[model samples]
Target: MTVIIGHNPNFVPFNGRGTLRHNEPLSKHTSWRIGGPAEWFYEPTDLEDLAQLIPQIPDNMPMMWMGLGSNLLVRDGGVRGMVILTAGLLDDMIFLDEYTLRVEAGVSCAKVARFAVNAGLTGAEFLAGIPGTMGGALAMNAGAWGSETWAIVQGVETMNRQGQHQRRSVTDYEVRYRHVKGPDNEWFVAAVLKLLPSTIEEGQEKIKALLRQRGESQPMGLPSCGSVFRNPANDYAARLIEKAGWKGRGVGGAYVSEKHANFIINQKAATAADVEALIEQIILSVEQQSGVRLIPEVRIVGEYATTKPFMSETPSS
Candidate 1:
């Protein structure tokens, strides 16, 4: 039996072991610390709990997945649907073999890198510099230090909206730089990675070097989504923005980082509209000057503050 709560038809109460919240502030979950509330937020306790809760959601209600919340921008009007948070709740990591490891979606990329290194594995050292969860990394093929998440992926387990699970191989999807296209209506639950055998000291050294390079280049202390735009073919996004003289440009409280032109930082109380406006301004100016139309790498979601009520029809209690 399903219980409808409050006046919102989409606000169905979850009876699972996980935590459920209504009107949760999305800014608290994102790296940029900018966004409106989420209509519904659910954090599953484990894989089994997640599977059980999937089918309980209303068919027409929208849903979205979140991890460490990097490379994401939620608009000011907030999300209209359920937001399933998998950051600390789906945490599970184990080795399938000497060189193969299985990591759940909630595991942080840094944790995966450290775990692999401690087990004397290489190739995952670059993950130490990625500031998101493994799930988010997989979704966007996140990369750092010249390596990508999908490069080491051997297989993955995905869960559909109907509480069904499927195991898929690398060939099941088209993986590109900072983008991935896979079976529709399925979200990744876990991934199997194959890494090269290496000494712990070696992996540690590589991770240290990568972190140093990132710290030197990025504004690590600021509230910003790591990279706002993807590099165009044969050129870098940061280079183009800097060449176009867009560094330190501001729109409201949001400004293009002078340290790295590809990053837009929130100095104080920056709204989603502010950041978005800044992004558009940069894109227009850069295209006008460099003839290269830069594409945003950040995943922008939710409704604009000016949009009408997402759910107008009230459900009878």
Candidate 2:
């Protein structure tokens, strides 16, 4: 096992100088519950501590910023360098104006939605159904119904690899269907969201309705990423996969969800490889059968052991 030492001379001091964990299982932190291990993981106490501590780490170390781990898939071989988790720390939300709110990266989407509703804001009701932090939602350009996350974002605060901060506008990023493009080295710290003033009762009612609608459509109690593939233009990926006869197909313990064709479920002891293979199979099969190629909305990363096939291999008798 590779040990993750925290004595990198280049690293700076932060709040209480937190310890590092070696070979920490990525599965423990992710929603999918399937990943090998991370070389190093750190959860700093606050933004000031992180800002001071991050610049001290060596420049060559690979780093990934994670929030809530809702839409990520880390492979079994594990991540190479450092994984910075912001779930436990960086929790702050403030009202900047009647129509605007400032939220830290760690705030959950559900909380943001409810907060807006309580404050009599209407446009942010869609956020209540998303199961992730603001940072992840922003990175994925996550949306539901008719609204995208970027549509409400007026400005964002981001921190670079060197721990320097910058304020950027929504126009800085090239927003697409489910992808976001902006400064490569920066990670979201906070965001200023624009909302419309409305009745508290109306906002609350809208959120309740959206949540009920999601429960009816998605597999609510499964270990899977939300909507594995992005909708292809005006058509739905789930409909395509279902039409291609992949709904009940599986690789090892990972099976395509019968309830929702676009979802891959960890039915019985499914490994990361099984889930990943099933995802690829769905993409390829849909493309070969229908002429349209499907693209994944879930983000895949990390590595796996060489002996483990991503898909099932035939047994040697």
Candidate 3:
């Protein structure tokens, strides 16, 4: 098999798709509102349009898939190649059966939660409060409270670098808590989620309560990437940070959220570097003080301008 990493094919323009200049600021794509630009950025109208452009793209060109960018952080140096925005192109959500739903990867988690509730489905209200698209959630095995995204996923439709698509079963993955692994280089296009039957009113009530809890516990109004670190062992990351007395710690525009210890917020006009530095400081302090190493839950991508600037204080978001 040939590697899809080296050739550059000319991209013919299509209707309902948009392309931008090289080095377009990545700040426009992330929830953190930070990042340099990608060498190329493309937003397709639909899956057909998306697939058409794939073969034209060079094999070695760095390709990054983007959804809502809620769980992502692109650095100041920007990305090297193509960044495909999936926000509008893959937003389909449909019923496959009485207890199963077909959801496109680009659909927002909140939208899916509402759709499930309106369709008399339960077990999906946990998605109501997540601030990312289904694809991002799937990539990160995004979870909250007691539920995770992949738990209800019965099957998934994925696309390869050559635009070849396939349907895979849940058993195909090595699933774990907040983690999912399958065939490499195959990204999710859609999912068939198995759900339980429930009343719309009941689901709505559950969503409301969850949202309320998030609002009270998190810095709901700030620009944050949600939880900064994964919980360690049986302990919560937030508690450790709070115990370290790092609350409200600020570096440039970023600050340790006074409201939630696990969240680092862009309090002012914070740069990506600001948040990055703060994350590191927190990790060093926590590890030195409590001997509990924290892991990040956020995805950090793109290049950093200075030495050793990429690794976060903890794990991937």
lDDT winner between candidates 1 and 3: 1
For all candidates in order, the CA lDDT equals 0.89, 0.82, 0.81
Candidate 2, RMSD to the unseen true structure: 6.2
**lDDT digits (tens) for residues 1-317 of candidate 1:** 23333355565566677777667789999999998778878878888888888988888989899998888999998898789999987889999989999999999999999999999999999899888999999999999877999999999999999988789999999999998999988999999999999999999999888989999999998899999999999999999999988898889999989999999999979999999998998899999999999999999999998877544434334
In terms of TM-score, how similar is model 1 to the real structure? 0.94
Per the 3 Å backbone cut-off, how many clashing residue pairs does candidate 3 have? 17
Ranking by TM-score: 1, 2, 3
* Per-residue accuracy of model 2 over 1-317 as CA lDDT, tens digit each: 11224344344333234556656777888777788777667777678767876787678988898888888888878787778887757779898988999988988899999999999987889998888899898898899897889899999999998888789989899997789999888999888999998999999899989999999888888788778899998899999999999988899988988888988887887888998898888888999988889988988998777744322221122
Q: Candidate 3 residues 1-317, lDDT tens each? A: 11121112233322224453344577987888888767667766667766666766788877899998888878787777778888766999889879999999999999999999999999889998899989888888899888999988889998888878789988889877667889987888898999999998999999999999988888886778889898988899999999998998889999898888999887788888888888888999999889998888888898876634322311212
- Off by more than 4 A, model 1: 1-12, 309-317
Error of 3 at 63 (Å): 0.9
Evaluate residue 126 in candidate 1 and report its C-alpha lDDT on the 0 to 100 scale: 89
> Using Cα atoms with residue i matched to residue i, what is each candidate's TM-score against the true structure?
0.94, 0.91, 0.90
